[model samples]
Target: MPKEKRPRIKNEDQYEALRDQGYSKEKSARIANTPDQVASKKGGKAPAYEEWTVKELYEKAREIGLSGISKLRKKELIERLRNH
Candidate 1:
């Protein structure tokens, strides 16, 4: 029998699942290392980004301190928000 190697991440299963879902390594590690109780309760209360107007998205980007949003179209803004 071979010994199983443990990862440094707090939740190996969650990390692997996130990776499989296409999340970046940094994002996966951050989410997996978060406490289960806190992570489960974490989520946005806002509506879907697609429903938001370009102006609304721009304001949100500004609020979040994102740069180079002044010239972004609605879809680009939405993509930026989701990736950010």
Candidate 2:
């Protein structure tokens, strides 16, 4: 029988540590995969959501698995993203 291959999880140690600290699997993976060191060194230059266009907001919301996306207004999408 062939041995099973381990799952490919980047920053696996940090991911497991975050899980132990009670972060959801999705959230943990997001954080673990983030280029935190690079971002902090360069600083996050992304504009705030309030400044983004409604279409951009919709795209961003959909990318993060927001539900009822087709029904959510731009304002509601912003709120959900903020609180997400």
On residues 1-84, what C-alpha lDDT tens digit does candidate 2 reach at each position? 984464556788988898899877777777778776763685478998889999999999889888887888778889988766
| Candidate lDDT values, in order | 0.85, 0.81
Error of 1 at 70 (Å): 0.8
Off by over 4 Å in 2: 1-22, 33-36, 82-84
- Tell me model 2's lDDT, rounded to 2 decimals: 0.81
**Number of the top-ranking candidate, with lDDT as the measure:** 1
For this target, which candidate reaches the highest TM-score against the unseen true structure?
1
Per-residue CA lDDT of candidate 1, range 1-84, in tens?
A: 874564479888999999899997877888899997887885779889988888888999999878998888899889888787
TM-score of each: 0.55, 0.53
